[model samples]
Target: MAVVFDKPTLLQRIAPIFQGFDGPLVFAILLLACAGLMTMYSVGFDHGSRFASHGRNMMLAAGVLFVVSQVPPQRLMALAVPMYVVGVALLLAVFLFGIQKKGAQRWLNVGVVIQPSELMKVAMPLMLAWWFQRREGQLKPLDFVVAGLLLAIPAALILKQPDLGTTLLVVASGLAVIFFAGLSWKLIIPPVLLGMVGVVTLIAMEPQWCAPDVDWRVLHEYQRQRVCTLLDPFKDPLGKGFHIIQGMIAIGSGGVWGKGFMQGTQTHLEFIPERTTDFIFAAFSEEFGLVGTLALMAAFLFLLIRGLIIAMEAPTLFSRLVAAAMTANFFVYAFVNMGMVSGILPVVGVPLPFISYGGTAMVTLGVCLGILMSVAKSKRLMQS
Candidate 1:
């Protein structure tokens, strides 16, 4: 008795790849991506090929997301150490021989110009998570000390490139992993309190500290200027303060209901600086108004909450740490960009997650979302 088995159809063959994906997370991403496209079209309409280019980047990012999501968490854990090593080696190479653009030596040229600091954003968390996973059941004070050393080395290297923004992000992601790995609150409170005190002291002494002749030894001259400008943008109105002032005007002009898409005076009249890049949040606010901004923030909040849920449900320590750290990355990106544009924080050249225009950043975002999806999928599969 000869029996024949039916071959799987294309849909059936590929079904496992799509199986176990978290629906709410996917919906949140889609909602943000749509908002990003609409906002880009409005802001980039007259800004050469930005709108088309942005759409292309989004497609490329989606491809990345799909490809990365297919990889299981165990594979990601295995890749962590090598990725961190390669990223750190590239950073050293950039330090030795890198391309200088706008007075910063941050880009390295192999076949193409690449910012090594950007790679650290993902690598730092991965490395720390891998380290903690290795000592999962029996972690010690020395383990955390070793993790801090790992984080500090790359952070110090990037800071030497004078890329403060990327350094902040890398440090934040690494720290998030450490925090989630069961570090004691007793060790965390002092530095935070000291930081708060330092901030208050700086604000109180701004007049003296920002004096023209005063030179801050720890900060580069441009960095010092940024802090001073943040303290009082009106002090240099048309000089260092131009970006912040213009951004605030655009945001305020949007009113409660917005000026309508493409009808932003500050945006179209060219009053806003970097209208399609770092300051796109201002352009978005100008055209969409308060209501639109709240809705956009809500989408971000949804993504953050969903990511946390996924992290908590993740089966392994590596997946949990990675998910939480990646979620922190998104939060920092949005908070820093919005804070700078609103004149509450210094201009640090951070971009709004989906709304900002940058191919590299878009690709990085795709990787983050993919990791989250992988973790979420792993949890569901284990349950089933």
Candidate 2:
């Protein structure tokens, strides 16, 4: 017998890539993406071509998502360590000789300027899931300690950059992996308890500690001011509290039905700062009102639930962890942004996922959706 090589035909080559696609996940994401486009059109039309830019970014992101879905989870697992290493290295580079803008040194000009902290959102989960998969059946307490250490190093560097938003995101993504990996309750309970108590203690001591003369050693001045402002926005109504105060007003003005598209007074009058980025949700609420807000929330909630269900059905431990963490990342992005805008939580600059106007953040989310689609498709491809 003679050996012969045959290239796959067009249909043969492409069919498997589209096989086992998760319909509900795809549908939910599309729904959210459409809503995002519509919302951006109304909120960002006057912001120097933001609507056009956002649409372009989203189309690019969707393409990335489609490309990523074609990659198998095993290959993704192999790439995990390299991605994590490169991401951490970039973070170090940023800390050393990075671009400085408006009091934060967060972007690196490595040929092209990029934010390294954004990479950690996906890299952290991929790395940790790979770590756990390697330790599979016989995992012990020491392994989790190592995982925490792995998580801590990059998180600490981002924190030093003083990007509270990215730091929160990185830590939350890592913690979701750790939590899903079955770490002991004893270890989990203490920190959570301490966090709760710390929140209470801070509230109690707000009057004394929030004073201008009081220098909190751990937190940067702006971070402290944000906390104080959260405690009592009225204290600096015209200054630090302005964003939140205006946000609340916009959200409240929506009532049962929104004021109608682009009819938001607060947004049109320029009372809302950063209306297309972190504060876009406020503009959304003002325009869409309570009904529109709830509908958006419901879409997000559906996506969250669907992602978790995929995690539950994942074929491998790595897939499960990655899917679950990515889902939580989406949840956190929405919750934190909404909380900060609505005056429930201190502002941390986290954007609303899939909705906020930023290229890097949109790319991160696109890759995340790719990974999730990969995970969901992995099992069905194998069984077929």
Candidate 3:
């Protein structure tokens, strides 16, 4: 007697690739992606291929997410040091031979024009997580000092590029890792308090400090202008304050319910600057209104909470640290972009995640989601 066996189907072969994915997390991402597409279409309907370009970028990001999610956590850990080193080296190259655009030298032309600082956003967290994982059981004060030095090197380099937005993100991600790795509140509270004091002092002295001939030595002239504008946008309503003023108007005009999709006067009339990019939040607010904005924020909050839960459940220190840091990155992106658009924070060119149209930023967001998925997958597989 002979026995026969049925061959495995293609779905069976591909099933493993999609197995172990976190369902809630995927749902959250889908919600954001759908929101992004709708917002993009409304804002870019007549903006010369922006809608098509955004769709293409999103598809490319989906590919990046799929490829990255397949890699296990251990493999990601292996790539940490190399990624950090290469990222830092590329930033150095940019500082030396980078292309200058609009008074900032942040892009490097290495076969393709790339913003190297974007790379550090992931690398900083990965490197710090890897370091803490290596010193898991026997952490010392000096270990944290070493981690701070590791973080500071790349941060300082990017800050030199004068890209304050990216610098804030990289620093925030790195600091998230440090905070999760058991840094004491005793260590954290002082700097935060001092920062609060500094902000208060600056607001109190705004009129005097913003006067002509006031050269803010620590900040670039444009950066100084941004701070002053944030304090009082009406002072230069037609010049330096145009973006903020327009953003605020669009947001405020979107009363309780939105003006209906594609019916935003401020948006279609061209009052909102960068309507499809940095200030997309304003465009979104205009069309969707306050109700839509709250729903959008709720989606973000859901994703953020799910990510933090994944970090807590991760088996290894590396996975936990990386997950926490990446989760914090999303918070920073959303907070900074919304705050700037609503006139509370200075405009720093940070894009609203998912909704903003930028290829590099979209790809970077994919990588972040991929890492979270990888970490979540690893935990589930270990249990089974």
**Top TM-score model:** 3
Cα lDDT tens digits, model 2, 14-87, are: 88768899999999999999988888898887777988999899989989999998888999999999999999
Which pairs clash (backbone N, Cα, C closer than 3 Å) in model 3? Answer: 258-289
Query: What's the CA RMSD of model 3 in angstroms?
Result: 0.8
Candidate 1 C-alpha lDDT tens digits along 144-238:
99999999999999999989999999999999999999999999999999999999999999999999999899999999999999999999899
User: Where does the lowest 10-residue lDDT sum fall in candidate 3?
Assistant: 45-54
What's each prediction's TM-score?
0.98, 0.95, 0.99
lDDT of 1: 0.94
- The TM-score of predicted model 1 comes to 0.98
Error of 2 at 358 (Å): 0.8
Q: Which stretches of candidate 2 lie over 4 Å from their true place?
A: 1-15
**Model 3 — TM-score against the truth?**
0.99
In order, what is each prediction's RMSD in angstroms?
1.1, 2.8, 0.8
